[model samples]
Target: MTALPETTAKKLGLVIDLDTCVGCHACVVACKGWNTENYGAPLSDQSAYGAAPKGTFLNRVHAYEVQPDTGAAQTVHFPKSCLHCEDAPCVTVCPTGASYKRVEDGIVLVNEDDCIGCGLCAWACPYGARELDKAAGVMKKCTLCVDRIYNENLPEEDREPACVRTCPAGARHFGDLGDPGSAVSQLVIEREGVDLMPELGTKPVNKYLPPRPKDVLDEIDVLSPFLAPVAEESKGLAGWLDRVLEKI
Candidate 1:
C-alpha cells in the first residue's frame, strides 16, 4: 500500500463554476484530444461503430435539470474528473504503488509502466474518476494536464490544462488553491464553493461553485391581443374607407 505525503507544497487544482458552464462539452473534447496525442498511450475506442461503443475519456460533463427553491427549473452542467484529493483512497489501495500523489503539486498520477491493470484504484475512487483503458491495459484518469502545464515550449497562456483553455463559457479556472491570495481561492471564498461529497473525507482539491437562482419570467396569455378590439370604431378617412369597403 502506498502512503500519501503528509502535506503537499502547493494544492494545484480547478475551480468550476456551475452557474456559468454551458454544457457545450468543449472541455470534454479538448481533454480527450490533448491526452490521446501528447500524454501516455493514446486513448482507445472499442467497437466505436458497433452496437456497443466504448471510449476512454479523461473528462466528462453531466447535465441535470434542477428546480431551485425560489426560481424556475434550470439545467446545471457539471464537469467531473479526478479531484487530486489530500487523502486519496486510490493511492492507498494501489498494490503496485503505480498510483501516487505528487508532493510538489498535489496532483495524483498513475505510472503506466508500473501499473498492473488492477481495478482497485477505480473501485477506491469515490468520485468515479478512474477508468481502465482496455487497449493500454492500465487505469487512467485526469492528470490535470501535467504534460501541458509544465511544457515551457508552449505559450505561457497555453500552459494551463486543455479543458481550462478550451472552455468556451470561461467556467473552469486553474490555480494553487493552497494560497489564500490566489485567484482560485478567492473565487471559491466569494462563491461559497462546495466539495463533492465532503462526508466521505476525501478532501477533494477541486471545488464547485453552486449555481445561482435563475430569474423567473411572468406568465403571458397568448390569446389576449387577438381577443381585444383594435378600436371602438374606424375614425376619420379610415372610417370613410371602411364604409366604402362595406358597401362594396
Candidate 2:
C-alpha cells in the first residue's frame, strides 16, 4: 500500500467557476488530446464508431439542471477530474504502490510501470477520476498536465494545463492553491468556493465556485414592446391597404 506525503510543498490544483462554464466540452477535448499525445500511452477507444463507444479520458463534463427555490431552473455545466486529495484513498488502497502523491506539488499520479491493470484505485476514488487504458493495460488519470507545466521549451503563457488553456469561457484556473495569496485562492475566497464532498474528508485541492442566482423576469415579457402592433388604427395609404385587404 502507498502512503501520502505528510505535507506537500505546494497544493497545485484547479478552481472551476460554475457560473461561467458553458458546457462547450472544449476542455474535455483538450485534455484528451494533450494526455494522449504528451503524457503517457495513447488513450484507447473501443468500437468508437459503433454502439456503446468507450474511450479513456482524463477529464469529463457533466451538466445538471438545478432548480432554485424561487426562479426558473438553470443548467450547470460541471467539469470534473482528479482533485489530488491530501488524503487520497486511491493511493493508500493501491496494493502495488503504483499510485502515489508527489511531495513537491501534491499531484496524485499512477506509475504505469508498477501498475498491474487492477481496478482497485478506480473503485477507491470517490470522484471516479481514474480510468484503465485497455490497450496499454495500465491505469490512466489526470496529472494536471505535469509535463507541460514544467516544460521549459513551452512559452510562459502555455505552462498551464491544456484544459485550462483551451477553456473558451475561462471557467478553469490552475495554480498553487496552497498559497492563500494566489489568484486562484483569492477567487475561491471571494466566490465562496466549495469542495466536492467535505464530509468524506478527502481534502481535495480543487474548488468549485457556486453558480450565482439568476434574475427572474417571469412577471413580464420584456420583448412585448417590440412585438406590439405598430398601429391599431391605420390612416391614409395604410388605411387604404387595410381596407382593401379586409374587402378581399
Candidate 3:
C-alpha cells in the first residue's frame, strides 16, 4: 500500500457552480480534447462505429430534473471529475507505485508508464473517476491539465485547465483550496460549498457550490400568450400568418 504525502501547501482543485452550469457538456469535451493530447496517451474509442461504442473520457456531466413541492421543476447540470483527496483511497490500493498524490498541489495522478492496467485504482475510487486506457494498457484519469497550467510555453492567461477556460457560463473555477485568500476558497466560503458524499471521509479538495434557489416561476403562466386561442379576427392560416406578421 502506498502512503500519502505528509502535508501539502496547496490543494489545487476545481470548484463547480451548479447554479450556472447550463448542461452544455462543454467542459466534458474540453477536458477530453486537451488531456488526450497533453497527457501521455490518446483517449481512444473501441469499435467506435460498431453497435456498442465505448470511449475514454476524463470528465462527464449529468443533468437531473428536480421538482420542488413549492415551485416548478429545475434542471441541474453537474460536472464530475477527480477531487484529488487528501486521503485518497486510490493511492493506497495501488499494487505498483503508479498512483500518487502531489504534496505540492495535492493533485492525484497515475503514472501511465508504470501502470499495469490492473483496475485496482478505479475500484478504490468512490467517485468512479478513473478509466482503463485500452490503447495504452494502463489506468488513466484527470491530471488537472498539469502540462498546460504550468507550461511556460503557453500564455499565462491560458494556463488553467481547458474545462475552466472553456466554460461559457463561467461556472467552473480552478485555484488553491488551501489558501483562504484564494478566489476558489473564498467562493467556497461564501457559497457554502459542499463535498460529495462527505460520510466517506476522503477530504476531497474539489468543492461544489449548490444551486441557489431561483425565483418562483410557477405562479406566472408562461404559456398564457400561446394558451389563449388565436384571435377570431383572423380567419384562416394565411390570414393568421398575416395577423401575426402585422402584430410584429
Q: What lDDT score is found at residue 14 in candidate 1?
A: 98
Q: Rank candidates by TM-score, best first.
A: 2, 1, 3
The C-alpha lDDT values of all candidates are: 0.93, 0.93, 0.91
Error of 1 at 180 (Å): 0.7
**Residue 52, model 3: Cα distance from true site in angstroms:** 1.9
What TM-score do all the candidates reach, one by one?
0.86, 0.87, 0.86
Mark the regions of model 1 whose C-alpha exceeds 4 Å error after superposition: 69-71, 216-248
Question: 1-248, model 2: which lDDT tens digit per residue?
Answer: 38899999999999999999999999999999999888778889999999899999999999999986876789999999999999999999898999999999999998888999889999998898999998999999999999989999999999999999999999999999999999999999999999998989999999999998786656777788779697789999989999999999
> Which residue runs does candidate 3 get wrong by more than 4 Å?
217-248
Candidate 2 local Cα displacement, residue 5, angstroms: 0.5
The TM-score obtained by model 2 is 0.87
What's the alpha carbon RMSD for model 1?
4.9
For candidate 3, which ten residues in a row score worst on lDDT? 215-224
Worst 10 residues of 2 by lDDT: 213-222
Q: Write the per-residue lDDT of candidate 1 for residues 153-247, one digit (tens) a residue.
A: 99999999999999989999999999999999999999999999999999999999999866667888998877868787988999999999999
Query: Between the candidate structures 1 and 3, which one is better when assessed by lDDT?
Result: 1
Ranked candidates (lDDT, high to low): 2, 1, 3
